[model samples]
Target: MALAMTDASMTDATITLPAIAPRHARDGKLRRMLSRMAILVITMVLVVPVGLVALGSGAGVIALPYEMFELARRAPLLFPAHMIASALVLLLAPAVILTRRRPEFHRPLGRLLGLFVVIGGLTALPVAIISHSTPLARAGFFAQGLVWLYLLGAAYVAIRARDIPRHAHLMTAMVAVTTGAVWFRVITGTAIALRLPFEPVYAASAWLGWMLPLALVLSNPRAFARLLSR
Candidate 1:
């Protein structure tokens, strides 16, 4: 009699619970794929144009137009150095993000990645100001550089304090900032390709670039938190 009552209660409880929808699983897989594609696209954008530009500049082919070339010439070494550092960050960030399961590898690689972030951010400030197409562009990029360094510093402090959760949040934010370089290229390239107004697009890219990635990271905080916990 007791076994029967228990069985009945179990059945009633199961029936009272809402049914799981099949579509939810598919939707989750789709979201994951879309996120991965976003990262892949950003990676390609960073690798291709930046690589070509670096090579062209090094070879003295000057693929950029006369006006842009003139601006680039202002801090010729810094521009290439910044681009190289950006590429390194792009490459290392994924490894660092994915290897949370392997602390042995992640720690050393993460330290190296942090170095790239510092180099990239520090170099970006001077280029932003020196190559100012407009006051808006200059201010936007300068602000980006500042924010990038701040987040990196915060993450470093968090880790030093052994605040794992805080460190995870700040590191996630820092990586998102690194993707801003790719977003800047994508936005600016699309605008130029479409023959839209330059200043408006460049100015917009400055903000959208970093903000987009940050939003993506924040939107999936739980997943990031899980990774960090691992």
Candidate 2:
């Protein structure tokens, strides 16, 4: 009787220990995944905009003549607004990168970024409409404007509903749109460096910025499954 009781107690201990161990292991794995995700988000927040600006500032070297010609043709009233909008975007790029970790700073700065996008869109879209730039350039600017508007509206909704997931999605979309400016330079630079056909490369790069993010988000397993069923 004594031997049977001892064996029963040992068996209960073994089963309980194994169950507790697995739960703790699962919790640890979840924590590690969350940490990794946080790091990735931080890196993206810092790198994308700043990297674009650095590339864009360089493009200004090659594009200066064209920009100057555009300025010469524009009304004085329109020029300063355009300059201000451009400066705001370039300056805020770094500010946004630096403040990503501070929610207090991040939220307000994000609002400002959204406002800048709207201002830029309003100022640039009409110019793009009439400009003699390639069709792709015109379409890119217009699409950028539309995306900025959507991003602004989505940001407002996210804040109102206090939905973190929605806010993240919208912000990611905004980043993708802003990245068009950078990718433009990159594609052009590559074409020039490699002595490839510049026009087609430039045109494709403009659209690819928007298309890549759309492809990524829509291709998510869960999102794809839902769309297929619908």
Candidate 3:
């Protein structure tokens, strides 16, 4: 779900053109390998600890870092239910990513992933609507849930029609939104760590977390139009 960008290394080596070309080629290939490895490492970091903490909080074995939600006091279990289901989405994301590379396993894992998405989205919608946050933040949060459900549904429709490319594009967009939870925490957590103003960052994260990723996925408007049209 969380894809790390490729890191290109710069060198100050003085060299002749004859040797430089081959060296650069080797460096390019190495960079690509490192990029893939970095993506996996980041995906793991996004999933494992965060997912476990959320899941543990729901189980009452760990404390939630934020203030008590009004929803929690009212229902006693609804907040935990939301967190646990969201945690499942994060934990299961990697398996879905990996299985996509394997044609035989892809459909089965996709079905499982879809099941969790529905549960997660269902649990999140109510919490988002009644969340104790600024109105703008709430709207952004609510939109995230709605868009998550919508894109995934679109993806399922695309695949059902045997439109592989459209399905892949839609799934890519859905994954971008799915990882917004991680991005939200990352943005706010960094702001907290830096002793920056929390309120603005928190509110901005609500939209930026999902929108930024989705924007990147759809950066080429014409290509994206074609993708959706298919």
Write candidate 3's Cα lDDT for 1-230 as tens digits. 12322221112233356588999978866765675677578787875787888888777788655554455665566677877877877888777766766878877878887887787777677777777778888888889988989989999999889998778787778877877888999999999999999989999999999999889786754444433331
Error (Å) of candidate 1 at residue 60 is 7.2
Candidate 1 weakest lDDT stretch, 10 residues? 50-59
Model 2 ranges off by over 4 Å:
1-63, 75-87, 90-101, 217-230
Give the candidates in order of TM-score, highest first.
3, 1, 2
Clash pairs of candidate 3? none
RMSD of each: 4.2, 7.8, 10.8
- Mark the regions of model 1 whose C-alpha exceeds 4 Å error after superposition: 1-10, 16-34, 37-68, 226-230
TM, every model = 0.77, 0.63, 0.78
lDDT of 1 by residue, 1-230 (tens): 99999999999878765444546766766766776777577556674465456445534675666755776688788876676676677677778877877899999999998898788889988888888468887888888889888998999999999997888898888888777866788899899899999889988888888888888777888876644442
lDDT of 2 by residue, 131-218 (tens): 6668986787677767767776886799789886566566555665665665566677788999999777867876775667555653
- By summed lDDT, the worst window of 10 consecutive residues in model 3 runs over 1-10
**Residue 115 lDDT (model 3):** 85
Please report how far candidate 2 places residue 48 from its true position, in Å: 8.0
- Position 185, candidate 1: lDDT: 81
